[model samples]
Target: MSQIAKTKLTQTQLDAHWMAYTGNRQFKQDPRLIASAEGHYYTDIDGRRIFDGLSGLWTCGLGHSVPSINEAVAKQIKTLDYSPAFQFGHEKSFLLAEKITEFMPAPLNRIFFTGSGSESVDTALKIARAYWRKKGKGTKTKFIGRAKGYHGAGVSGFSVGGIPANRTLYGQGLESYHLPHTQVPGTEFSKGMPEKGKERAEELLNLINMHDASNIAAVIVEPMSGSGGVIVPPVGYLQRLRQICDEHDILLIFDEVITGFGRMGAKTGAEAFGVTPDIITLAKQVTNGAIPMGAVAFKQEIYDTFMETGGADYMLEVPHGYTYSAHPIACAAGLASLEAITQQNLIDRVKEMSPIWEACVHQLKAASPLVTDIRNYGFASGMSIAHIDGEPAKRPFQIAMRMWEKGYYVRYGADTIQLAPPFTTEKSEMDSLINALGDTLKEQH
Candidate 1:
């Protein structure tokens, strides 16, 4: 009943807290707990230094314990801890919303805030359907998501999301179809965007014909699939998708949760890939992982449609929002993080470091026969491992655990090992991280 201050966790205490996306039974038997993090490394409970390979789940490109973000959070909690979400407003929220628009592409100036990436996906879906209804085309309610696309875990997002394990047990979600994934055969180790899969984007035409574009609300995808193993869209792939959406009258949504905010070496994925969507969902790095926040940015037309058609100023334009939509503390964190990103020019930092990153990781192709494929774009990368016993995820799990013991932190998902080093990482740190990974793979059975 009292506060537990001990850094070490008892077996009973560990059992009380169930972890998400983890094998709980195995983890409690041999846990890897991080006690603190600074700069680009984490210190475990036993005080061993571990390199931060994945940038805190792809959320901390500026690295950990940033001074500006820390100070802003402390001052905000003292000044304005919380604020009412409805009808009322806070100055920080307005400021944060405006700052966010500066990074988004032009005409996508309207902003809506939420609490996490999942919520942002759901909010974008709702906005798409609402926009159709306001235009008197309520029949436009279907959605199209690509195979291997990862939106998030909410009902709307989960249903539209394409990962089988994430969707199988949940049953049906919103009426949605999936386009084929872009990992075209025979194009495994190509650098940047592979040129072979441009036709894959044309699969959207089949889905449009099968269900009629008149009934479709939108097509949503990650510009570069992060959780789906960093599968980069082929050259001209996104452009073709944008062109198709234009002709069909269907809205296009880019779930940039993983690729937004400097991960793609640009203001947003739309800028990196040069393919703008009608709606863009964002989160993770909005506050540099210091505070939880997400947002949806859309073209001004969507917002104007609701305002012009709504009955009166007293009526709600759109009857939806979370209680913590724009908490003052989160707004403060967001503003500080954006300011730090701008001042430090971290986006350019990613661009400068990406070439060295790509060359270092690609060397693993010859390190061992177990590595089957490597995909990368900007600072994000993933390497697929040869499946053992037809269990694709097993080898990656073993590889990651070995990486942990060797003092590096990387993400293992599906059958791949993913890496996204902090933008501040130097060339020497990059070499050490990649060399360690190569040695680990060669050591694996």
Candidate 2:
């Protein structure tokens, strides 16, 4: 049992710890705490089983307390518990890197490890700038992102992330511009990749024309936007972006934090969509959420440029990394998670499950008047509700709170309720999830 399970916290004690991205005052007044999790359910402090509808913030897609991951973490802790990441090497890090690269597309084989998705995004941005510098294009420092696209929360991620609320307070940390988001008016309630919004990719060209292609280092976007609602790209959108980037000599970066692993029914969104980026930022299910770990995968040319540009053999090619970069425990967990995913053909399983998920989620559009749109791809989905009065995000927040009371835990942001069930969840469980959501919507009306 964990320490949280053993000890109960008072309202005052909870107040001491400031939470992130939460309404702290309201939470303290009525806290909803989870003591433990197993399979597709979380056991609350009072021993109530709550269905995990959001995959624990779009992380644990393999479910909780996975035996393979638990065993790997336990065994790794018993052996080499910690290692200094800099100036020293560990077998597990190199082995895990190799394992990860095997699943990546050709030429995108080099991996730089980080502690979280934020770090991975920042690292990719740094690599893009550094690679341009090495190629004698030191002025290529600007980055282009799409509106409503979300990278992680690092400084660079924040700059490139196009969510207005996430950026207005922090100020742009990098010289970044945004392309129009692909969620057009006609594409609402799209089942998979919508047919509309393909022209939205041309917005990248407009930015390139406005900013000048030579000034841009890279363009970063989530293949399927996760946090800024589960905004899946249009059918030909990603391919067009790839073509534009190539024509302009601009590097492309895909923030695959949520879509990587089996979430998209493929090893990576690049593979699923048949469009490859120069760099791919990964985290989340990389370790099945068993440990904090992220990685930046680069093409061979990018890796070689850094290696060849350094002044001395002993000098660091890229002067960036976390102390926990490639932590042994994380590597072990990642290896175990990857093994389980591949050996069990979890990606194929997700493909089989996606159609059913699409059908179940789309049905909400007709059942709930509040549902403005429903978007789905692979095993992930988002149901966007009409704003309550003039206040956006209030209705979804209320719905989420009601869901918690009814023994379901989901995620909501900006009038959107997102759901990404674990790959291991059964068809009946999915039916129950949709039914509960439908019932909740009905109650609201």
296, model 2: CA deviation in Å? 0.7
The digit string of per-residue lDDT tens for model 1 on 258-310 reads 89889989999999999999999999999988888999999999999999998
Per-model CA lDDT versus the true structure: 0.92, 0.90
TM-score of 1: 0.98
Task: List where candidate 2 sits over 4 angstroms from the true fold.
Answer: 1-7
Tens digits of per-residue lDDT, candidate 2, 1-445, equal 5434344776568889899889988877677788899999999887889999988878898899999999999999999999999999899999999988987888899999999999999999998998999999998999998899888777888899988888899864888999999889989887899999999999888898899988999999999999988999899999999999999999999999999988999999999999999999999999989899999999999999988888799999889899999999999999998999999999999999899888888889877898999999999999888887888888899999999988998899887999999998888988888888999999887
Q: Which candidate should be chosen as best, given lDDT against the real structure?
A: 1
Question: Which ranges in model 1 have alpha carbons more than 4 Å from their true place?
Answer: 1-7
**Candidate 2 RMSD to the correct structure:** 2.3
Where does candidate 2 have its weakest 10-residue lDDT segment? Answer: 1-10
Report lDDT (Cα) of residue 3, candidate 2. 34
